[model samples]
Each structure stands twice: as C-alpha cells, then as structure tokens.
Target: MRRMLLTFCLLSLLPVTYAVACLWDSETLEQERNKFPGTLEVITGNFPRHSPAFYQWRLDDRLNKLANDPDNDRWLDDVAVSYEKLGRHSEAIEVAESQLQRNPDRYETLANLATFLIHDGQWEAGLRYIDRALEVNPDAHFGRERYQRLLVQYLLQNFPDGQVEYPLAAGDRIDFPTFLVNDQPPGEDGQPPKLSIEQRQAAVQGVVGMMRFSQHDHPVLLEVLGQLLTETYRPKVDAKQLAARCYLLLADSAASPATQAAYEQLAKKSLNLQATHKSGSEGQMGLRAVRRELSGELAAAKKRYNSIVLKEKRWIASGVDVEAAYRQYVNSVQW
Candidate 1:
C-alpha cells in the first residue's frame, strides 16, 4: 500500500511539474526576443505557439516541407542544436535520439545526444550512448576524440576517493609521465590525478587571477606571469609550456570558456563605473596632525606597494613566456 501510494504521488506530480515548466517567463521570452530583433511581440501563445514543444510536434511538418523543398541537412541539425542550446537538453536528446533510431549510423545525432547527456550529468547514460556511438562506426567522426577526452575528464572526476592506498588507480594506467608521453593519454581508468592539497590551493589562486585578468583591465602578461609563477614554482606546474599555452590561449579569446568569460566580464564591467562625488573632506586636520601623518606614515605605505610592484619589473626581461627571466622575480618554489 505504501509503495502504491508513493507511485501514485509521483505520477500525479509529473503533469503538475510539466505544466509549470511550460509557462513562459521573462527570461525565456527575453531570450527569444532577440531571435527576431525589432519584433518584440512577434511570438507567443497567439501565433502558431512557438511553444517549447513545437520542435517535437512540428518536426514532422518541417521535415515534410523540407522533403518537397530543396534545403540543406543543416536545416535539421539547426533545429536540434538550437533546442539543446536553449537548455532543453531532454527535448534535444529526444529529437536527436529519434532521428538516430531511424538512421542508426547518424554520427551527428548520436554524438550530439551523448553531449547533451554528459552536460546534463547523466554520466553513465552518456557513456552508454557513447559506447553505442562507437559501435555505430568507430571512425565515422574524428570529433569523437573530444568526446573521449571529456570521458577521461568525467571518469577522473568520479574516481573513488580514498578507495585504495595507491596514489594512482589501476585505471589511472598512465602516470603524469605516461600521459605526457602519449600527449597526455587519459589513464585507462579515465581519471586525472587528484591534485594535492597544495596544488589545489595554487589552482584556486591561479584561477582567481585568471578571472581578474580575464575580466579586469589588468595586463595579461603580468597576470599570466604571476599565476604561472605561483602555480608551477610556488604550487608547481611541472609542464611550464603547457600551462603557459593554457593561459595565453585563454587570454587570446580563442577558446570557448575563455571567450565566454571574457565577454561576460566585458558586459558586467561595462555596467560599472566609479561614482562622482560632491565635495566633503575638509576638517583641515589641524595642519600639525596632517603634517605628522603624511611625514611619518603615508610615505611608508606608498613605498610598500611600490616595492611590490617594482619587484615585478624584472620579469619583463625574459618576456612573460620565458622561465629564466621570471624565475628570479617570482622565486622558484614547487607550484
């Protein structure tokens, strides 16, 4: 009786939740607003209902239209991709999966479903699809390499903590050296080495610095130099060139996370500015007190910050990318 009641409750909640999910909102409506700029009220419950379900419901209609009409396969890929982009991962997965069912060898749909599943954190499910995808035709898509990398990353993330005393798991077949040899081949077990506590601390600091240079008007060279110095020597990034490349790559806006973070920073920064103020600080600290303060203390504080900054100048010599030049300024500590 209790199990039956629980099942009934869950069944009842389904439609209730689904109904709420259907309600259009300021966020959703606003995102769509730009799909057709200048046509603010151009869509909604009125015109053909650009409902979230439209893709599932009207896919047939669109495909029928495309069949009689000449259009690129991109038309279908676009619809699936767009839905996935909108956070409708399940919907995207459904559409892509349905298409794959009809065409078992469709790498695009299978790979895309695998992506949506992984991004949604359905790791086991995602891998299952990926395995099926491989069986579909192993070499069908060269891009599967990226999926394998992601698979390695995911496995590493899920590696059992403290399960065994060995530093590296059996699946972590490759040591740092092994991976380096095979272009950082993922351990057969799919796990990345668990960073040490010290390494974790450095990574946190490095990522924060990355955030600052990424968002603020700070010099990229200096930020990268400082971060790499701390990470490798202080924290210890043994792969100097690889780390440098990662930082430079992020700074260049050539990579996705870097590009997204950069633009978001730009947008947020564009919205902020120092406030202008109207006059008020003249208690004229009895000229004696003012003189005492400035002459005795203010100069010291100024010199400290100045000294810290001055120490950074030596790195300018080898160029931020070079080690010998920066090693002295940053000091050689294990990152």
Candidate 2:
C-alpha cells in the first residue's frame, strides 16, 4: 500500500516539475527576446510554437554574439532588414543607426536607414542620409537609383503646389513656375508681364541644373522635368524645340514598349509641328535622326547622323554638339 502511495505522489510531482521547467524556459526566452517594445506584442498576437518571432529570436541571439564585432556588421544589416520585414521600422532604424555609429562609411547601412526613414515619413532626413550614402559610394547603382526615387517622392509630397524655387547664380534666386497651360493668356491684371526669352531660358537652365546635380536618369524624374520644361517654356520659347527636347527625354527614359510608343507619338507630333512651322534647324535634323533610329530605320538614321556629324559642328540654340550627340545615338542603338 505504501509503495502504491509513493508512486502516486511521484506522478503528482511530475506535473509540478514540468510546470516549473516550462516557466524557466519561458523566462529565459523572454530574457533572450528583443527588448524592443512592439516585438513582444507582435510575438504574443501570433503565438505559434515556431513563429517569425521565434526565428527572429534565434537571429537576435546571433546578432547579440556579433554585436561588438565590426567584421560581422553584415549580420546587423540582416537583423535590421528582418525588423523592417516585420514592419518594425523604428527598431530597424535603431539598428541601422547603431551600426552606423561604429562604421559611418557603411553605405548599405546608410541606405537601409534612409529607406526606413522614408517609410516612416521622415523624408527630408531620409534624403539627407541618401545623399550621405551617395557621397560614401557614388558608384553604388542601387543607392543612386533609390536616391532618385526618394527625391521624386519628397518633391511630389512637398511641392504639390507646382512651384519650385532654385538659384540661377550665387545670390540670384528664381521662382520657376511649373503650371501646364495650352496657351499663355493675360494675367489677372489684364496685362500679362512679358518675360524675355533670356529670362525663360534662365529659368529652364536653373531647373535643369538642379536636376542634373541630383543625377536624374530616372523615368519618373525625367517625366516631371519634361512637364516642368514644357510648361515653363511653352509660349515663351519655340514650341517644336520644346516638344523635341521633351520627346527625347521621354523616349530615352521609356522602359516599356507601351511607354516607348507613347513618347514616339509625341515625337511624331513634334515632327509635324516642325513641318508646319518650317523650322528645319539643326535641332529638327537631330530629332529626325533620333526618330528614324527609334523606328528601326537604322540605315536612314545612320545616313542622317553621318551627315550631321560631318557638316554641323553644333546646334547652338539647344546647346547640343551635333557630333557628340550623334556618337551617343550610335552607342545607344548599337546594342
């Protein structure tokens, strides 16, 4: 009877022992878990035995091990990216910043922080970091592209009023207008202020200079710049020339067949305008060659470009060197 009672008591104590063991493991895991505020909440809400949180917890252990090792900073990037994937942007930013303090020249970490900042709506600061990343490694293709995109997003959000202020020269500021209008009408005073062609050109140059400094080969930025140039120069400058430049920009940046077709249609319209206006200037000639190349008329394009390269030294009105432009065209079409 005493042996039976002893076995029963041991079995009862087995449940207590298992409970104690579970509590100890839970406490240890809690201590090992990331101390970031939202981490626990996320883990609790989707509490599976082996959830993302569980995996992340394991990753954190590795990260902790490598925390003081500069040679293993890539693990920090991995942890930051994991946090970002979990939508813990704040924690991602924190990790990126912490790693950057140790190695300020980490371009990848800088980009990661910039991305998180942009995602968190801190666009201005994000752009600053992106600029820093570019300064750190100008040859970073991905960083450059991301910087262009983030810049466009920042401009779109902040400059929705369609007005951009830029400097033409030192201490000479200009407020360039970006309002698209089919025709320039009189102002509210019934007497429109006539801006000279020089003034219009200056404004266009200022905006272009700003974009050039930003390293904008991006399609979206090109599109925005095209619109701004067209709007700023519409009635003040030659319409065909304006259309030609816009068409070239749009065409060169077009990535898809549909987009290429749309820009081609616009270029055709410019060609028609050139015919109507009887403006057979060097700009028109260069645009014609470009259009031929785009239409797969390689022989005609080569013939036209060869003629331009041999005869025309420059297209001064548009500030393009004919020979140089022809070389670029050849390079683009050769592939």
Candidate 3:
C-alpha cells in the first residue's frame, strides 16, 4: 500500500485536463484506495501487475462510490477504458455508450467508446467514433489506428480477395514508401497503424490493384503500389526484384516524364527496402542459399514491364510522355 501510494503520487504530473484528473488516489495524504474518486486502475504499459490487490481495491471502492451518484459523475468513460485494458469488452461498451450519450461532443469519451465497439466487432459504430476522434484531431493516432483497422475489416467482409480505398482526412491514400531499410520505420505520428498484418497487406494490395485496374491511370498509384509490392516481397528474400518489378512497371506505364521520374524514385526506394533483408543469420547453409539466389541470373522481366506499359498508357489519352516510361523500361530490361 505504501509503495503503491508513492508510485501513484510519483507519476501524477501537473494536471492536464482529463488525462491526469481522470486517475484515482487516496483522499487523505499518505492514504491509498480507501477514498479515491475515479474508477481507473491505470495499469500503463511500463507499470505491470505488481499490485493487483491495490488496483482491485481501488476499483471496488470507486464502483461503490459511483453507484451512489451514478447519474451525475462522469467516471463512466474512465471505467470503460479500464475495462478495455482488462479485456472486459461487454462492460466497456456499456459504460462507453452511456458516457457518450451524456456528452456527445466529448471526443475522449467517443474514442474510448469506439475502442470497445471495435473489440465487440460493432464496426459501423466503431467507425463513427473513429470519425469523431479524427474531427477532434485528424492526427489522433489512437483514433486513426482504430479507424484504419475498421476500414480493412469492412473491406474484407464485403470483398473476399478484393479491396477498397479509405478517405483519410490527411489525404485519400498514404504516400507509399520508397524501397529502403530503416529499422524503426516512420509513419504518421498520431495515426495509429492497423493491427492485422494480413489485413494491412490486403488493403495495400487493393489500392495497388485499383490503380492498375483504372484504364485512365492515376499518377499517385505508382507510389502506393510500390509500397504494397515492397512489403509483399518481405524480409529474408533473395533477389526479390519485387522492388524492380514495381519500378519497371511504373516506368512503362507512366504517362509523362515527371510521372516516370516519380516511378523511378518510388521503385529505387523499393530496392533499398529489400536490401535491408540481406546477410543476416550467417551460417554456411544460409550463406550458400543467399549466394545461390542473390548471385543467380535474373530471368528476363517481361510480364512486369508489360503490365506497367498497359497500366500507365491506358489512362494518358491526354498527351502523356510515353517515352519517359519507355526509356526507363528499356534500361531496366536485361536479356
């Protein structure tokens, strides 16, 4: 009890609106959990379950207090967040919705409510909360992360082995990464990344495919498609010119010189990303495989080039620079 009190007081920085005010603490100095206000246990990532009793005691005490004046207190949202942390989905949603109705514009409440909704697989409502968070702050990482995941889920359910585009407030689609290997990749800071790896891959694939499916080409598609292909040919690969494939395709299909340049740049980034996979787990067998595969002659790449040509040109009826993609295509081809 003494240790937990000290820990709680220690973490409480200057109050910043709801973030700190939301936590519970002892009423008297040096006391803990006997007379606290809020129901949140606050088991943050760094603080593990070292004191389960302390948290439970606090929660129980707070629950009793709330039962007395449940209609007036705004602790429901905090309780919901705590329930979510404990994987108590049903209770979390109940509290989250209750809080949301009380104060519809309270973004924090809506965001917390949405989390439980997603956990409960109530996606349509979850997306509404996500949009609420975005409206509060388009860069809200937590909201965007949840929102992005829901979008993928919606797509998967609607289109098995198909894809859709999410209209993000920042933009319609992300600026695809060029092929390079950076240990800690940077993405939109406050935008939460989707959790499912397969879902993310599928979403990327859908966007890339849509760009190609368009007869009238989209210049932005090359960058987006390049990122998908880069991830597709993932780690521990040997000569997966999936990087070059993206480049070669973009190079052929690009409508103008400027667009072709963008393709070249995006493709180069892909190769660099692939390079990060080389020369780890150094064993004789692994080394042999790497040597055999990396050193092997790359078969002449025609399918990739042809796809790009057809893709970039079909859309550029309005005088696109066909030569730009053509020159880049010829340069990349190895007989």
Best by TM-score: 3
The digit string of per-residue lDDT tens for model 2 on 109-170 reads 98788878866757677778878887887666523434344344545444545343221101
Cα lDDT for residue 187, model 2? 64
lDDT of 2 at 244: 43
Candidate 3: tens digits of C-alpha lDDT, residues 52-160: 2222333454577689878543556546655665557888788867776777777767667765785565766677777787677665542244425434354444433
Write down the lDDT that model 2 would get: 0.49
* Higher-scoring candidate on TM-score, 1 or 3: 3
Off by over 4 Å in 2: 1-61, 64-71, 142-335
**lDDT for predicted candidate 1 compared with the true structure:** 0.40
Residue-by-residue lDDT tens digits, candidate 1, 141-239: 443333343433434443524122111212444322223234344456996434444443343343333233122212332223223222222213222
Where model 1 places Cα greater than 4 Å from the true spot, the runs are: 1-74, 140-143, 146-153, 156-335
